[model samples]
Target: MKARKKISRRKHEVSTSNLIRHEVIGLRVTVVHSLNDKFIGISGTLIDESRNMFKLKCKDNVIRVIPKEVCIFKFELPDGDSVKVDGRMLNGRAEERIKMKRRKVVWPLIVEKQLKKARFQPEICEVLMFDP
Candidate 1:
């Protein structure tokens, strides 16, 4: 007998705090930074997403494929706030990432990236943030 994968019907709000668990295909996205200089400033409607790449339809009607790992993205929320996310946090397949119940590591990685620029030790930030 083949086991069926149960899908989640509960819709989680798409906020900066829980954006990783929502479907982001129709949202607007911009490549805020990338390893390749040529890919910077590419703003478009996100049409498709994969584990390691994003397919965007730009204003010129061109579909550009952007690598996720090396790029930082600024995503526009429905409420008009833009959230900058490190692509590494979205490293897994969509279904797997969304369905994850315990994301103990995601926050630390993102916070560490931000705190690194602010000259804070990542270990200290992690311990404080996850402290009971």
Candidate 2:
């Protein structure tokens, strides 16, 4: 009898924080928040980007230039996680973002707070009932 060998698939890791440093052209993005009323709800594919602006190809095939300082962007990571980033945080050419100094933001604490306020409210209430 011949022994069968199992094939293992290699996992590809994607860094959520590095999205702004890489080529974002052709990626689908939504304007989650915008200081400009016209751009507040725009959703489109990013066709081009510069240090201060992004050219988005809308459904009507019209390209719109959005100022980076005035908007927040939402996009999906290759690993299926969705992230929202302030446009100001991503200011700079794609290449420059790699060399830029990133701010130290604690995410776990924020996520924990949100989790405690959601879905597990009953358990949280029980724990609170027995508080010191």
Each model's TM-score?
A: 0.69, 0.63
lDDT (0 to 1) per candidate: 0.73, 0.66
lDDT of 2 by residue, 1-132 (tens): 999897643222334555655567777888876545688789888899899999999999999999876567887666677667767666778787756556433335654565455443332121101001
Looking at model 2, residue 55 earns an lDDT score of 95
Give the distance in Å from residue 26's predicted Cα in candidate 2 to where it truly belongs: 1.6
Question: Local error of candidate 1 at 60, Å?
Answer: 0.6
Highest-lDDT candidate: 1
Clashing residue pairs for model 1: none
